[model samples]
Target: MFMRRSHDFTFTGWHMAGVVCLFFGTIISVNVYMAYQAVHSWSGLVVENTYVASQQFNGKVEEAKHLAASGLSGTLTVGAGMIRYRMVDAADRPVDADELTVRFKRPVGDHQDFELLLSPVGSGVHEARREVLPGHWIVEVTGLKSGERILHHSKRIAVTGPAS
Candidate 1:
């Protein structure tokens, strides 16, 4: 002969409600977190006016092509509170410019963006003294002579050490 035991446990509506709440709560919590990160990490605006920028895109492209065909290039070095640029032509001869400027921009935000005007240091070399923060940056260098653009260069770099 055998004896059987009875238990009081049961799956009720309250239990179903709790499971549903937990599943949806997790999903909603994750979505809110992702939304917050997306909003704070990067500003969505690249230019102030999208239509105006689009209208000038072709002209800018042509300018870039012309600048590239000129065979004029520059080497940029940034570190230790100094920014140096040396411009050269196709023949590897030193090139001179009337004015030169460098723009340092953060990839994600504009808060740290800044521009520095470089002073000529003889032999086609330009120098600027500034402590650049160590991080990923988009650097833009421009050279002009007689109010006309002579050199335009942009590059991405990572600085892992201190700015000093």
Candidate 2:
């Protein structure tokens, strides 16, 4: 009887220890999973905010096209510390306006592109103080009243040396 009792007590002790270990392990796993979820949620919010901001800017540009249709003709010149865009009206008259925004296509493999806002100095001329990269680029002019795009009058401009 004594030996039997001793054996039973040993088995009970081992079972109790296993149960404790399993409980601790389960709690730890749950905590780790919760932490991972929190981090994922935070990153998702940041990405969503970035996407929203970009969409807002695009919408504004679309609206400007209808508002500045009359002033959306001209040549865009990109050079060192300056970008010049020209526009002509339907009556062959040149209208000068300030704040001509130039947006360039994002570089290949890059997620963001360049945007420059230029001011008009003379008739049909808009100027900005910003250096543009010399490569394949797409230019779009905003702030025109004729609902036409002037900056990207053509497909793409290859800046070999400085923009003339």
Candidate 3:
């Protein structure tokens, strides 16, 4: 009876060790899977958001191309006083609309930029009050139709201060 009881005790000890090992293994596996999913989830969000934003600009590019095909030309000039822009639409007609937006490229990077909306004062002319730093910039113009963009145009400009 003594030998039988000792044998039962040894078996119980081994079983408890096995149970502890299994519990720890399960926890480690779950942690690894969560880390893997976190990395993949963020990249998926970045790709999806970029795609959706680009789709919104598709129609605006098409409209700009259409206007350009009809001998329409525009000019964007940036200086110390104010940022000025002009747009000539198709059929040799000047475009003056209340829904024009102007965006200036910030010095940080291409993705980080500032945008300003200009008010149209006369035929084909738009003006905005901008206090921009002295640097090179890319100016982008967009036409909004009922809050949706319908045309886009871009140009490069440089702002410089007086010689010291």
Candidate 3 lDDT tens digits, 25-46:
9999999999988765443333
Query: How does candidate 1 fare on TM-score?
Result: 0.91
Best by TM-score: 1
For candidate 1, list the clashing residue pairs, or say none: none
TM-score, one value per model: 0.91, 0.47, 0.53
Off by over 4 Å in 3: 1-67, 90-92, 107-112, 145-150, 162-164
Candidate 2 RMSD computed on C-alpha atoms after optimal superposition onto the true structure? 11.0
Q: Local distance difference test, per candidate?
A: 0.93, 0.65, 0.71
Candidate 2 Cα outliers beyond 4 Å, as residue runs: 1-72, 144-154, 162-164
- Residue 6, model 2: Cα distance from true site in angstroms: 78
- lDDT by residue (1-164, candidate 1, tens digit) is 87766885889999999999999999999999999998998887799999999999999999999999999998999888889999999998999899999999999978889999999998899998899889999999999999999999999989778874
| Candidate 1 lDDT for residue 68 | 99
Candidate 2's error at 91, in angstroms?
A: 3.7
